[model samples]
Target: MLKQKAGTRSPDLTVVEMRRALAQRIKLLAEKPGEHPTAIPGLSLYHRTTPTPCFRASYEPGLSIFVQGRKRILLGGTEYLCDDSSFLLSSIDVPAQSQILEASEKTPLLSIFLRLDLPTVREVLSRDDIPESPPSTHRQGLVAGETTVGLIGAVMRMLELLDTPEDIPFLGALAHREILYRILRTPQAERLRAIATSGDLGQRTARAISWLRENYAKPLHMEDLASTARMGVSTLHHQFRALTAMSPLQYQKQLRLQTARQRMLMDGLDATTAAYEVGYESVSQFSREYSRFFGLPPIRDVKALKNSNTALVSVA
Candidate 1:
């Protein structure tokens, strides 16, 4: 697990005010205690009345800010605990397990997900006034950082625009850019920089990830993936694992399982059919892997997931 930053400043009065405003805005915008789409594009609000189960889901490239409760996100064997004082950012698509750890009927877990825009990030990076590139670090795609007053204020502004639909067209994009700028100024900036740079090792590894996502049903070939990434096999493996916290093969397995699970749960595909559809050759192997990943047999797991009271809605 990543250690929390030492000597980090506690929330000041401004930050406290921002957090309170964010919580109130989310509560107002969220019609009920569930996820809801926001007026601004790429923004989603989640309101939970109680603690949640450890839900295994794929986290896309985005930012999640907690304003009222806490969440524990498990990536690989590492667990990141984030609450009202911090924020979580995922610069690339990753399979992660997350659960709302602190909430109640009185003060539910109120959070917001802001889908990061790569194009806007690149636009911000292109400016000559942008800060000099920091030394490269082999950080994982998922990160937790202290939430600054600026970031929360920007989010509050975006939420404030919800009541004025006409202003969203004019001000939403600017607010989004400001949010990105605030993120770029944080320690999370280096990871975002790696993704934004065109020829960096991180970006090349991202290409391989993209290919796997689009062609997960196809057999994985290391040489082909390396060739696609324009890197040597050894470098590809090293950088891919460093950026994603999993080897290429392991990453592909996650994609396969997640895709298969979604197929079974949402599309009502049977275990055998979903397995083959997701490129699993052996039914037994698929079942074993599925059981390990999802904690139950395919049929049973889907039944439990559907029957669960937890509601997650992603506008992205």
Candidate 2:
């Protein structure tokens, strides 16, 4: 159960009640254990009936609200523990490992994930009425915070819109704006704002990350990447590590490996073929790295994943 503060407030509902309502709605929509995309674009609901093993996945820029159960995310050496009251904000694309820690058939893990619309975030930031918070010294891409009643209410309304199909095209945009506005009002908004603001180092580093993600199969050149972000090589390296919790080369390797795993599982590609397809020149080197990262060789890992009934949940 979600632990409530002594005097948490809401206009017509307590925080815990609001969370329960949201969870019930999500449970109704997501009847099975997997990601369920809704009519609203960029919004997805997740349900897991049992605790899962740690799985490597990539998280894009988004806001994830947990209404039930608990999860843990590992970014580099840092571990973030999230429960019913927690919200995770990802300011950029990142690779990480995640596991569902507290879940059961009676009380399954439930969450609402909304992919951040950069244009809407920028629009919300442009408003003069939004309260200003202190700038964050360390601009990490993924941060977790406690959820508030107001934020939960906005998310609940977003889910409520699914019942009315015609209202989505018009009200959905407004809902998106309001959700972003609520997030910007929080102290955690600084990292998000820095990334959305033009010419900011955070945004520049984000551009470099985007480039790396798009061209993961290609050979990486530090000078070219630095030039793409319009920053000096050393500065780009500093800011890139500051935001992603890993060096650029490490990030690229993760992308390459994850994509290769997906292809081998989903496309039936052999280990040698998958390695070469994902820019690995030597199959032996790819197999060694894959084993080290995934704790199993390519064939064994893919076979295990294929036999398992659980799907990898990527929203963190």
What candidate 1 gets wrong by more than 4 Å, as runs, is 4-7, 136-138, 310-316
- For candidate 2, lDDT tens digit of each residue in 199-241? 8999999999999989999999999999999999999999988
- Clash tally, candidates in order: 0, 0
lDDT of 1 by residue, 221-302 (tens): 9999999999999999998888777899989998888888888888889999999999999999999998997789999888
Clashing residue pairs in candidate 1 (N, C-alpha, C atoms within 3 angstroms): none
Clashing pairs in 2: none
- Each candidate: what lDDT? 0.82, 0.87
Per-residue error for 145 in candidate 2, Å, reads 1.2
TM-score of 2: 0.94
C-alpha RMSD for every candidate: 2.1, 3.4
Q: In candidate 2, where is summed lDDT lowest over 10 consecutive residues? A: 1-10
- Pick by lDDT: which candidate is best? 2
